[model samples]
Target: MDYYKVNSKNLSLLKERVSVPTYDRTNVKAGILHIGIGGFHRAHEAFYTDELLNKNSNSNWGICGVALLSFDQRIYQTLKDQNGLYTLIVKELDGTLTKTIIGSIVDYLFAPENPIAVIERIANPEIKIITLTITEGGYNYNEATGEFEIENPSIQKDLKNPNDPKTVFGYLTQGLKLRKENNVSGCTIQSCDNIQGNGHVTKKMLLSYVKHAEPELVSWIESHVSFPNSMVDRITPATVSADMAALKETSGIEDAWPVVCEPFKQWVIEDDFIAGRPAWEKVGAQFVEDVVPYEKMKLSLLNAGHSVLGILGTLIGYSTIDEVVNDTVVSAFLEAYMEQEVIPTLGDLEGVDLNEYKKSLLQRFGNIYIKDQVDRICSESSAKIPKFMLPTVQSQLKDGGSIELAAFVIASWAIYSLGVDENGTKIPIKDAVKAVLHEKAVAAKSNPKAFLDIESIFGSLADSESFVEVFTKSYQNIMQFGVKKCLIDLNSKF
Candidate 1:
């Protein structure tokens, strides 16, 4: 027999590999308009929604996936080509693989091509919730001023042509403007980004953006809209053509774009939707009053562990996260840092075990099949630090807790940001502020204090004498003694 296709013809063949959606996708209503439909979105939110749709008959929540930026070209075209049907493969530590054909995405639009269509879709009374997964750097943030960059090129363009907006902020504000004009009800804007106070930050950024773009629309939005903070977690790696081939080989289904992730997934959402929402809680999703405890734990421990392994892994000559976490020294450093420095700053949960979570993170990072690239993990050092590790550092510094390991992680990034590893090979820096990082990194080699001068990443930490001393010493030590020796020595502190 020939290979199975993802369409209706090969349902029997596909059944062995994936749990295909049985519900009539045509009957599903577009209740959520999700922006930034990337791999993370497909694996996390789409997976959750797929479950809810499959289990419940009364749910009307189908996602209208929208690609807002130019970088989403590959995914936009792929999803369009596949008719929004793709395979998700969850890889386990023991080599057990489970596949699911997700069908929650009923429609998709590349917003850059037709911004007006996207805005109009957003204004639809049926779209009760709008979600986002745009990275931290995507927001129009001015690190120096600590406000939304109201005059950003995109925002400026959107302001002049609010009817046909380009930016996500523009599309949303204008969509709300249209909704207000039509006397439609307000919708929820839920942010799935890893930033702390994600909902609060989003509300502030949007309010700031709309203030400059549409002044009158601001007051109406303030009363009608809701910004719900969420904590989303899953270790979904970058899927190349190899992953697609793997799905084809294993399942005999030719999926254009396949998503591969760790077996673990988590979403803790604040139940604050302005419009009616999905009964996602019926299908393993946690609905809580406050997502702060879960968010802080995830960001501080898991994400911060990635930061440690990422920069240190590169400097120490490891390529992937598994390789980095497999190293006893790197793994030990992360565990110690979390228990002593990171965990101290997090709030205690009712039923969750913190130590088990930490251990599980190590196992997830050490998953052989995931093959999460350390360079990819460490790619955007400037952004990851402030979100994942800075909260812990800031909190630890205030309480006089152990920050030696945290200081070492930052020092490792400064050294790695120099664009050369310990082996004298060129390293690639892929940060939003790469130019500034490169400049300061080169200077920081001789004078580590210079790296801390990047106020956006480091803030006022450079001014503190004690922090300066610890960070400078660590950077110098890493440069002189190398990563393994420095980390091994740092572990001796505990």
Candidate 2:
């Protein structure tokens, strides 16, 4: 059971079954500085970059990862200890596994350790492209208003002291200012986050923050900086102890922080980089002129499909996505939801076949080896539902299409927020607005319409009598009959 710990010193000790980086990690220069080094980043972006390094002679696209929040301390320490090297375990559908040591990330900076060092690295002329994988909430923008939250306490603190900045906005502003002072050419700011129009949103939020800090820098940023929208997809679950154990047993590499994900990976980016970028397209990435259609497709189907399964599966006592999809009724329901409700919302997509995409989605979700947890998908329903699911609901309502499935999904979420399942097992509610959902969900036990009144979440859909009727009916069905009976009856309808 003795295994070499995953680090620079242990690379030579790795088993032949495991694939180590063929390129020289020591000579790699940090051309891409990535913020928010989460599991998704390690699995998706870093995986692509690793392949690029191995295939081509270009060593300039090495990633220098930054961990901004205090919460990232553990990951930072793990990466630092491993010399920015970690195992990527890809779980195949037939339970086969492929373990590779991802060496794209050569350097790491924990911002909390030294803010100035982080800023200086960003200001480095050699770091041609700065990428971000910060989650949707990390942007610090008002979603409803589409404006930066300037009154935020963190924003206030960052504005007052730009030198010792606390927020991404502050750090970026200071770094860009330093670059300008040093006469360095502007770099590309690419966002690998899941947000729709991520590049445009980043540019807007960053410029808004910078305008308040320094008005003179706005015009310069407009001309120099490039923000490329990207659509990134990978089912990378949180790395648990089991993943580490699996890596140790399968490859004899004792990695402290290994990433586990499904075999499928995708990235569709807008072809716009100011300074330069890696030839990622050589490694299964697509460069398009516009990423909006792809964004809309993925968010509507794949992302919303996760929400559908996550909410319903939790109530039905299913722990993982495969378990949810394996059930005949549940899988049928998902297929019907995509075919009747979701596909209609998306118009003609270039170079995409809707049927094939949906088929692929079903196969991906049912990959038993992945073990994508329902709880991971269920977390942050308050933020996720609005972005991924509700738009479909609104579209269905406008076009007078069937809204029963969408209503059922929302009702399931409302029931889930009640903190207990049908069998009286406590369901842990994980959301930023947990208290609000709990309060509203409790109030809805008596008045079913009360939960819909949160305009921030539901918007004008609450005012529609047809939606209220269907939603209330679905709510009553689940409360009176039970999850399985209600699901069967609902499935029969489609």
Q: TM per model?
A: 0.97, 0.97
Residue lDDT tens for model 2, 1-494: 56799898888777355899999999999999999999999999999999999996589999999999889999999999999999999998889888899999999999988999999999999999999988877888754567788999999999999888888999999899888888889999999887889999999999999999977889889988999999999999888888888777866788899999999989999999999889999999999999999998999899999999888899989889999999988889889999999999999999999999999999999998888889999987887887888888889999999899889889988899999887888998888779989999999999889999877677677789999999999999999998788889988888
lDDT of 2 at 2: 61
What is the TM-score of candidate 1? 0.97
In candidate 1, stretches whose alpha carbon ends up further than 4 angstroms from where it belongs are 8-13, 143-145
lDDT of 2: 0.90
The candidate 1 region of ten consecutive residues with least summed lDDT is: 1-10
Q: Candidate 1, residues 36-87: lDDT per residue as tens digits?
A: 9988999999999999899865567999999998878888888887778888
| lDDT of every predicted structure (CA atoms) | 0.87, 0.90
Q: Give the poorly placed runs of model 2, Cα more than 4 Å off.
A: none
Instruction: Give the lDDT of residue 358 in candidate 2.
Output: 98
